[model samples]
Target: MFTLPHHIEFLSDRWVEEGRKFLVGEAPKIRERPAPAERLRGRPLSVSGRFTQAPPHMNLPRDVGCFSVHFDGEAFAVTTSFDPAADLVIEGDYQAALTGAQMVGIAAPGAFRTLRREIDHLYGPEALKVRGAIADPMALEVLSGLFDHLGRKTVENPDLAHRAARQGLSGKIREMEAQGYTIVENAITPEFADEARETILRTLSMHGHQTMNWMLYHGRALERLALNPSLMTLIDASLGRGAVIASLSCIRRGAGPGFIPIHTDYSHVPEPYPAFAMTGVGVWAFEDWTEASGPTVLVPGSHRARRHPRSSDDPGAGVPIVMPKGSVVFFTEGVWHWQGDRTEAGERVTLHSHFNRGILRSLEARRIDEQMIYRNPPRLGEMLGEDDWFEKTTAAGRDYMRFNYMRQLLAFNEAGKQAILAEPQAAAPTKSARRAVPA
Candidate 1:
């Protein structure tokens, strides 16, 4: 397994040191590019960055929230101080700056355009500010290349590996691959589950509705649960990165016959579905799920059929997924499923988190609220489609920074999934061997 030496928080001192080393190592490659090489033939270039209002969890020092990069034609050096005489100075909200720095693999021609578009259209003018100018516009491209190189080594989904190991998710991932669905028992604490249930009930009462869409905007609990690390790892493995929120909905159902019919999630698609997955869902159980309490039932290994269930198919073959409170059942790859009848329950409450591949349109229209983005970490924004380049356009062209960002993110997510699957599964100890060991 590939394990990081230590957790490197974004924009921390360690992140800066690692970024410096990465830039130093990539200096030679940057010089090989003809246009950038010619642009920096003789003149030295310097750029400084300043960020403020960093989230408390980031642990960045208030006084040292700045860094400068200096390139002396052939070599590069990074320092933890502002450069008053630098050719360019970029300043912005700490989170917004992190967003800009995380965009990797952007082409030189679209670098400046991407930055300008993000500042004006996405982050707002007050969120990002740029000062000073270079005589040669090509310098922006060279600097952009340097930043991209650094970002490749630094910014990443930091919790994926540790969370997977902590939750023992490798076997779950394998199970999901083989059966098209998996249940993670006690994915959250019972206390949290109760809190989420109460929040949902309150929202339902306020809105006078049995079901609510856009539940992520309803409460903090929904937001946190929606971006659960373990659930996200599974989604990343199945849907690839840059997957946007298709819907975050809550349902309050009383004792009655199952209303939803047996079907696949892939609506309007032709038969013999493609090998790749298009959509996935993680249904959260707010209370213990029993066969009679109304649980989601699915046909095991049916995804391998690669088609929807026919009327002749036996619904009796489906098995109910029974799990404890705070658990979640994740199903993908167009699995055939339906809600079971509720005979014993007062009410069955569930929060459904549905996600689609980056290339597909979402079921719920995105409402890009700035306060919501500001309150949560970049992960929440990412699921809300803030990080990817979609539905964004200008008279000049598309946002290449986000376009390239999604490409790089998807590649990284796939590689990480493979690594998780490659890990060796530990064997259970034999009875005699267990007896020989000391208690």
Candidate 2:
């Protein structure tokens, strides 16, 4: 018992007809490659729902109708409706339906610029098929091939392997290389961990919410905790010669559906699933990570798995990262992981620092003003990205800065830096030069 606005159905008919022509190979090919409007030349769409549009941040509509149809590329007639008999049932805000409709090529362009920016981050080369499938039904086999090409699953990219091998790895580093992660027990002094724990708890009371970018707010103590020398060495070992901090935040586990779901932190970057660690995470435990306390879980050796875990897969295959307070866990970005469900009554807290290979973008926004940079120690300022602007602008400039910083940080000896600098550009394995390790 639902119907659409009269105008929406008429407009939908035009788009749907266009979609059908593209799918049937009847539409003429233009100079543009993979154009969505061109492909959906004659597809008919039918949806049933009544939705209200908000100025921004829309919600899902109730009841389904033709006007409620969203854009989806898998089929030529991409549609959505909650009319019980509709193809898809959206349960949230009507604005979400509008957004999805626009995303798949439905709806008008009222606020699509902001939505497109988010879409770019969500849909990369691997998932670009929605556009392709909508554009060319004949591209099914080609799309399959594209997905295969994107997954370069192997132990490690040899160039990064060579670089890591050259670091004169300690036993811990070697273990990390073999297992994809390593837990450094008692890496931090008890007194230091206690102080950091106190700081986090005090800050948590003021913030009320669980996780936050607590580093800047707490001042020098939190900064010192994040820049612990031993932890940085381990991080740099895997992140190659010039890794820098991308974000510094805290995650406090709470009792709910779980604070964070099981997932990899690797989707932020574009890629052909690099065989090395492009991003690394360092978690300094402020309290014990016990089974009851809902510790973080990691799938052993999954860092090399170029694909993400599907819903049907077994989550129990992962092992919890259990360690004492004051210990630290370091892991490569690609590893499939999620925070464990907290069955206990209280909460557990951990300070996390995400480090990225200098070439990648930072996870959080940062400003490198002179006053702020000069206030911190030179080494700390470097991690805070004081010199990042020069590295981000041009290719040659980035290389020059990377080499210089690596030399200063002692990421490599003088001879090692010289050897790396002399190599042909193609000889470097993946663009990300660090290897994967476990936590």
Candidate 3:
């Protein structure tokens, strides 16, 4: 009786063939509107204050923000509201801004900055109700909405979409400049990783997806995040289940790209569950994400920006991540980002994935009828692909096409992949890792 990793498994093509017998309806089409918060605000609510603090991961200066429990205490004005927690001390100064250990750039002052130089991203609730400490249904709803919205449109504000497209090759350059990424090890077993990769690639092939957006791993990638197990195990030993998947999937480099742009990753639903919510994203480069194969460029701390600025508009901050395979480039997803073109040649293989929990799929995207998927030009047989042909999923009893609990569960099963910093790991270490160490 071997214990299978939760939510993932391998299925024989024959077994999968038989499972597709009775088709389930496809998921509902999505609306291009803001977010799906309206649906989940049903739970009750309350907002309170305590002398607590955010998890260690969310404390990065650029990643930090000021929130007032009462408008009376400080003259400060926070752009948005976040979850209420105990032990969360409302700091009136910049000391909590950022610790030196969290700072990334060499040009920045000192060992590290105490506060974020600026606050760029803001997810204000159009209408929110903060109760005592019961959890605001509306805020939670907004968080869930942002999570889903950012999934499809990396740039939550589409106004920045086309601009972030970066030289029409997608925003790799800007992604590198604006946001950084991280690489973790042995987060997922090879067997589990293969399942995730196969699911994404197979899904893409079935869909006949090609071209710039052909990076199916972007929208459909994993959202669970893991630090160096040393980092996580060390932290978990301190916080227990309170440890959540803070950030995941911030870059994917390719070739022949140009232009740098802006964007953000929706992160209302952090990983592990209720305790880990409201964090951003991170990325790991498996192959060499170079100038040749457009690499994700980013604007430092741009997660606080209105949008990811173009490299053309702003210079210097833009660095193409020459993309050494083993380093972990950790950055906030809510920050601005884009990509650079492959000055050389050949494409790079980078995987940007993450893990999060508690955000529900919008009934807005719910597929009540199997016909929508069966008939959808974008989701037909080729897209959903040979559910009949090649292989099948053991994801039975779960709604593969519906916006039910399973979608997130499926995502969870694939979340928190050990950041792969080199070529696929072999039974024995490969030469690729001779230098794939994190900076």
Task: List per-prediction Cα lDDT, in the order shown.
Answer: 0.72, 0.51, 0.30
TM-score of each: 0.64, 0.52, 0.31
Report the C-alpha displacement of residue 388, candidate 3, in angstroms: 34
lDDT of model 1, residue 349: 95
lDDT of 1 by residue, 267-351 (tens): 7778788888899999999999988888888887788888989999998868787888888889999999999999994999999
Model 2, range 1-439, lDDT digits (tens) per residue?
Answer: 0001111211133333433444333445422455443344344332334433221111223222233333344443333323434343333223233223322111224323433433332222222112111233434322222212211110011122232332222444555555566676666556667878778878877879677873654754575566454455566566753457778888776765566777877864554468667888878877777777787788877776666667887887687787778778787847778887777787688888888876677777765655444333333554655433444556444544434544444433333333443443332222112222223
Tens-digit per-residue lDDT, 138-185, candidate 3: 544433332222222110111112211211112222222223332233
What lDDT does candidate 3 reach at residue 121?
8
Model 3 residue 94 lDDT? 21
Which residue runs of candidate 3 sit more than 4 Å off their true CA positions?
Answer: 1-203, 211-254, 258-260, 266-279, 304-315, 322-328, 354-439
* TM-score, structure 1 vs. true: 0.64
Model 3, residue 184: C-alpha shift (Å): 4.4
